[model samples]
Target: MSILITGATGLLGRAIYAQCQAQFPTLDIIGTGFSRAQAPLVQLDLNDAAAVRAFFAKYQPSVVIHAAAERKPDVCENDPEQTLALNVETSRLLAELCHEQQSRLFFISTDYVFDGKNAPYAENATPNPLNFYGKSKMMAEQAIVAINPSHTIIRVPVLYGEVEYLAESAVTVIAQQIQQNPQSSHDHWAVRYPTHVADVAQTIADLIALPAAQSAGIFHVSDSQAMTKYDMACVIAAALGQNASSLVAVPEPTQSAARPYNCALKDTRLKQLGIVHSRKFDVAIQQIITRS
Candidate 1:
């Protein structure tokens, strides 16, 4: 079956597009992007209603993985309008279009949906987002289910893998900061599960392989290893053969936007399907660092 992947130029979307091609070589794979669109990747603005509809009509993809979004908490906080338009409005439009075309939509959501008070969140847990980014995704989730109950919502935690630049991902940005300034400080108050993008892409592919009825609704995909920004920085320091002691660990909230301490997503639904893929943070980060 043919597949459409939005935000193809993005970190996660790029990985998803490549992974899908590797897994399903014979199937049609169309990628959409804005700034970085190339020959194979179409330049389609998801915010434009007419363009999105026209493109969907032309491709008639059986499945659409909507991975495009404004994920930064601070950015979303700074410009709520843009965040709402890109994250929430875009999903609303895609949901409507996918339903009209009878194509299943797999929306990429964030673990930021929950407050830090809760430890491990189940699929059925109610979202109490601590940031605008998370709230937008939560609203988009509601819109998607309302527009098309058969659609899927895949919520993932902090992601890092195969970046075009270190700044592209929060996980890799730690390395970038340390490289630039060995005395850089990192937040130690928050705990995060940094899942590899490839694993999440593989999880999506496995879900797409299942029947629509079986894979519909919410699913959490994340690595089990927990680490704060300080923890990640230390790991990066070790990989660089630098002393981890040089990095300062700030124990209070530092960002402009409010952040949840820990949002550990429980993949009970995925466990039931017997589909899982994960890797150790230290080992994977080393490979990524070496590659860069």
Candidate 2:
């Protein structure tokens, strides 16, 4: 069986690709990104339906993990058209193709789908996104479900792990800032579960390995531990052996798009499926630092 991964150059996509290769060595894997043309990965703009269709026809994958999106909330808010094209339209096209081809689809969603009014959202919670990015993802999720209910939807929160790009993740960005200036401070308002990307990848692999009848629902994969950006920054600083005392904790600043203050998710579904294996924030941070 062949599996195709979109946004392969991204932090989560890269980790998933690596883990799929490592754990399922005999599985055929194809990865696509915007401009990167590395081995096992080709450049394919998901926005172009013709390109996507051609690639799908060529590969004829039995599974497609859709991970490409306009992830930045501000960018999505400012450019709603681009966001719709990438996040919604592309997803619709992929869903239709997957349905036609009888391919199982795995969509990586975010905890931002839920409003911050409720903390530790469950897998079955209704989504009320606060920003265009989140709304776009919610729309995609709905479209995927409507098009093919058998698809797997995995929602994750604030992922951080080893990456080819050091500044790709918020955790690494905070670490870089602290390395540059120890007195750097960050927002303490929004609480998030900084899940490790490796954990998310493993969860996807495990889901793929499961029987089809048992793996076709929404699942939340996140660390049980939640922390604010400030707490995360302090942990990252401490991991780097830098004194975190000087790191300031300030209120969240205003932005173009509204951010959910409590977007932490509870992986009850994953736990029930015996697939929840998230690392603590501090331990994950240390692993990232060590790898770096």
Q: Top lDDT: which candidate number?
A: 1
How many pairs of residues in model 2 come into backbone collision? 0
Model 2 global lDDT (CA atoms, 0 to 1): 0.87
Q: Estimate each model's TM-score.
A: 0.99, 0.96
Tens digit per residue, CA lDDT, model 2, 1-292: 9989999899999989988898889989888898765775899988888989999999999989998887989999999999999999999999999999999999999998988898878888899999998999999999999998889999988888886655888768898888888999788888887888889999999999998768897998888777888898889888999899999998875677899989878888777887867667787778878787
Model 1 residue pairs with clashes: none
Clashing residue pairs for model 2: none
Residue 117 shift from truth in candidate 2, angstroms: 0.7
Q: Write the per-residue lDDT of candidate 1 for residues 81-174, one digit (tens) a residue.
A: 9999999999999999889888999999999999978889999999999989999999999999999888999999999999988899999989
lDDT of 1: 0.94
